[model samples]
Target: MTKLYASLALGLLAAACGGGGGSAPIATENASAPAPVAAAPAAAPPADSTIDCPMFPASAIFNTRIDDTARFPVHADNAAWQELVGRATPFTANWGTSSNPSDLQDYWGMPFNVVDAAATQWPLVSFDYAASGLVFEASYPAQSDCASSADGSGVVRGCTQVPASQRRFPFPSGTTLAEGGDCGGPSGCGDRHVLVVDKAACRLWEAFYAHRIAGQWYAVATASWDLRSNAMRPDGWGAADAAGLPITPLLAKANEAASGEIRHALRVTFRDAALSLQHVWPARFAAGSDNPGAIPFGSLLRLRADFAIPDAWSPQAKAVARAAQRYGLYVADNGADLHVQGAPDSAWDPAVWQQLRSITMADMEFVDTGAITRDARFAKDSLQAGW
Candidate 1:
């Protein structure tokens, strides 16, 4: 059975209070309105520079610490997911140097690009499998035009939003896609995700199954978000990841881990068979099997608070363990079970990564995100009003 949360009571009080009391009025109609706002799209939190790029507002769910049990609600399906996902499965760190430890460049994890200044421009070709109805901004000085046509899958796609970004990302010719290597996949072999953090614009752009062909780029789906805003994809829309979540923020970066603390949740993946076809708040698209009580996309899996981080472990490993206990992990994509995603760096000590492998699903539990999502006004949104 699902657990009840105080957040629902707070929602009632917030509604009964006409929400007139709080200053964070995302939107308001008549104060005496008979019912709370329908599941209408809520206004995004105003964007600003106080927080770094790729990190949403401090109040956002992704950045908030779930260790504060009072402020956030536990999801109803927590136990069900754990029973299905199992507690003894060991977690894997998906970043580090493999076979050729002598070769610094030989490592795993997706390649992420940071854009702080000028770069060569490449045309943003139409998508082959974008989530229908989502709007994307177009390039300012229009990109080189190409005939919109069928992709390798023979599915036709084109730009929908006329004045938005993302359809035109900031990759120079020959830029590598996610998972590395030359990105000239004319027919698409892998996910080939491309992630960019545009600090100047305080925006994040991500594309899935991206292909760089003949100096132009095309993708199956794309998502662009204002780092400062609480904007969320409409329910059931897919992005670079299946959970409709951003990829960069969830990664456990080497620099951040070496600093001794990672403040946000990390991303994890599971086999398709362990995933439920249904999704939870903030997760727009649902894929995988429809097994009853199976884990859903966007489920929060936290390291049990009692699980001690061995004192002898490297600071990097200890830091990740702490975050798993605090902010937790979000089921983001379909892949190996309990695979924890991280940023690959030369600075990473493979020994430290090896220590992290000791962590298993048995040391974790699911968090009910119901209360954190109470304020969200749309099925697709995960925005939460600031406390």
Candidate 2:
């Protein structure tokens, strides 16, 4: 983690200092200067818009954990990427040992490996946008009843028809449990799933750990509800439906049935362009604080090639060069003095340059200029083809 942070800080510093090994900043024309690159086409709008509402419904459920043999492929549309980037808002919590009971500490205090471990799991869960659904695969130790069913033949079968008496308690003999919940229940789960609408926060909260028993999946835990404003009702507007019952009774039953110690990985889909913009742009703007207003319109530009430093440079020099490559430098004039942004930091880690590179100039805007000199002596002797 420290090494990663150091590497990132170097990139940031290089970007701030400008000019080492990274791609040169896009040359902007002075008022009299001619334009270089043509304006890029606008990005297409997202496919859905309703998913952007803050109060939109969400759910968390457990699923049957599969062995390493069960493969979970990446979503064809890269919805996982969108969800992660959208939800990358700063979160603070205590860090703790993987299994040790009393090792809790602040969230960011945890090692990067721990954070990465959890993040990598995002794509492991399955998602369906048309149905607004999510499913997790979990595993529990093998049990006698599970073996009796069909010698593991029926384990992967779709949702079972649990009787009313059997539904009230945990599944009889599976070692693992997997859960799923969606806006529409008939397609996601029959009697086992609960539905919730307009309660986005609660759904997000519960989904974090609705699956996993002793580090495995044992059974599916599901919920569904409707979010509505009711002046006549307490708590104002809140969730209403879950697997068919009102929210209150469902929650009480959930608490009594399980310890509520569940971990979940959420995969959100952008229904339309509006939601994508709302979720992605602000984060980029905030991250560019080091460069201040230098990043154009908060757009990230892809690099033509991966920048690398040759072995000829000393380690320290190589570090500087690497930073320069990862974070392109900008030479801007502030009104009072020349200042540099994106300097490497000792505290912060460098994010993937590739991701940053994917942004374009149109996505960013030049909010301010630092300083410029009009004196002939300060001007270049001859016009340089590229800056």
Candidate 3:
């Protein structure tokens, strides 16, 4: 399958970012950038969609424990990136605990759906950016879900390009796109990320700028993966998430917190003005600022080991704080500085999560991931994050 390649200048991609609570900033700096070349994540294990199912195998990067500061010391660039991100930028928990999407205060957290692998699938799509080079030619799920039209045309947008990828995802019928409620119910505008998982098959399908137009689904960019494997997306390929990373695995889930531990890293974003042109290993692309001395994708920021979890905090908050001290958070995308991503669930208590906002960038340090033997070895094209 020879895939049609998109240009580095994907002008039509996410003009608006659902993740950022605003318009998606185009990477004008990457217009002249070359595409990435890398290995796809491969190998796998038996899978299931059950609640107790693990997000990924133990060896997967998300599950790798990085709190051993003795072995994984702070990166040399840690101080610089921290200073650049600003010490005063407070940590903002960007998810809702309420189940009612309409009850969201801000543009609520990103949403995901789980379904059986055998569910009906559709390849209905069309790329908006000049990202033909990034298209993987895989099929995606589209169950004829429709966003009510503003124009009342009663015409469904047929596929000029059929785009759901090789793996299938299906949001339960009527699942709202991320920020869907805040933007304008289902017809709203925002990053509109749609993440669907096949629990039984251990597969995930994600799309950016997703919408159901005229009784059909559509997106500018999309990516899919087999959760049970460690191989990455083919080097240089674009994914729905800005960093070319999976969105859900890194999310701060209430259920995980209830279990008393978050084994994997959490997802975070900083302002694009401070993003680096370069991305690290595990991050297939750079989706932030072109500014020099800017932060880069795949950067790790750990809560200082000495930072104490206040006794007054909720158990969920304590669990997240402990995870930050241990597994830490990854600079997964370009968004507001210090904003941590999570799923919207009623289980998330607003009171406790609010307390997490006090831990600012001043309390964190970056991990020099190149120090790790397993992480450093997964190089893509000529790009490598390890020292």
Candidate 4:
């Protein structure tokens, strides 16, 4: 097995950094400004209450309500997407019921403690956020020439406008960017990653298996998303994540915690539990084993909608609970069973946060995903003209 820290670096980094990998200081200096791109209209919420399982009133990332009213061929109003709702399954240990002698570590096993959130220490992946540079660096991609050697070297080869089919926003020239993270090292620490944020344009770019050698960034895979749109990763493509999804939208940010409700689904991990390196729709990884019962990467596990929340629970705990019941949790990586993620915040009460452990697999059910992967690559015109 890979080092636990290494295995964790991917999911945690995405949560901490942009897309995936580890924490790092987002470049505060302006490298290149991007042209302003009008934000896409929110996907109109569906009038059919039956199809809208989790009522995400707005785009969790962009602060715009998705127009659930419009039909999203990808998921929102898709018949295949609706079919997965209420698909029930008891959460098994490691997503399987074998009950073998396992010795995996759960990152979320420890209760929240002040020491855990000490500023000097590297915040765990769950706690990393954009404000602190733990998550994203609001900058632009670099404008430089790429050598053939740079293609696979994990080095930043300068910023180029990504193809419309590949990117959701217009990438301006002269954006500064890099790859890789070092959770244990300086600003960008942990595993390899790539990050690009166009503040002026309100966009983000990221990649997995990112690298940096001699102050240059490189990556095996990269993706871009418009902050304003309720866009989703194409069904079968992995975006810096084995799950083929964006990590930022799924994180439990401090603001959300403070709001007394996490409006979106959160990310979770398991102990070396991936089905494979190549994934299914919503997942880009393959099956880890032949076990048909194993939970694949990107599988959505949701708390029963009918589950009741205790009034005694703290605001943070209740917020998390509400999200689980509403949006559910997405399996992002392999490590610790039933370990949900949370952003770092010194203000969080340790005792209150510990209550999150009270939540368990017993409270959730695996969402059935039947035709999740049916869609092909997203066409440039799939969204509105401005997006």
lDDT of each: 0.60, 0.20, 0.61, 0.40
- lDDT of candidate 2 over 85-120, digit per residue (tens): 333321111111122212222111111001111112
* Per-residue alpha-carbon lDDT of candidate 4 for residues 3-48, written as tens digits (9 for 90 to 100): 3223434543343343545543322112353322334445433211
Please give the lDDT score at residue 22 for candidate 4.
Answer: 56
Candidate 2: regions farther than 4 A off: 1-98, 106-153, 156-160, 164-387
Which 10-residue span in candidate 4 carries the lowest summed lDDT?
110-119
What order do you get sorting by TM-score, best first? 3, 1, 4, 2
Question: Candidate 3 at residue 94, lDDT?
Answer: 76
Writing each residue's lDDT as its tens digit, candidate 1 over 1-387 gives: 000111123322333455245444212111233322233233333221232464776656667788866655455666666667677778788886532323335556765766642453434555532322332321211111111212111111123423233345555344454554442243424556677666665666676656655544566555666566665644545567777678877888877888788888899998877887667766665554455667878888888777888999999889899998888898887888899997667777777767987887777788876564554553335454344
Residue 344 lDDT, candidate 1, scale 0-100: 64
- Per-candidate Cα RMSD to the true structure, in Å, reads 11.4, 25.7, 10.6, 13.9
**Alpha-carbon deviation at 23 in model 2, angstroms:** 61
lDDT of 3 by residue, 1-387 (tens): 001112223412432221256433322211354433233243222222243345655656666678889878988888888888888888888787666666657437886777554553443454332234332233221211111122111112112222323222254455554645446523345567787775655666677666555455556556665565454664444466667778878888777776667777799987777777567767766654367767777788889998888998887888888888888888877778898888787777677567898898989998877665355455453322222
**Model 1 residue 4 lDDT score:** 11
Q: Which has the greatest TM-score?
A: 3
Worst 10 residues of 1 by lDDT: 147-156
Pairing residues by index, what is the TM-score of model 3?
A: 0.74
**Among all candidates shown, the one with the greatest lDDT:** 3
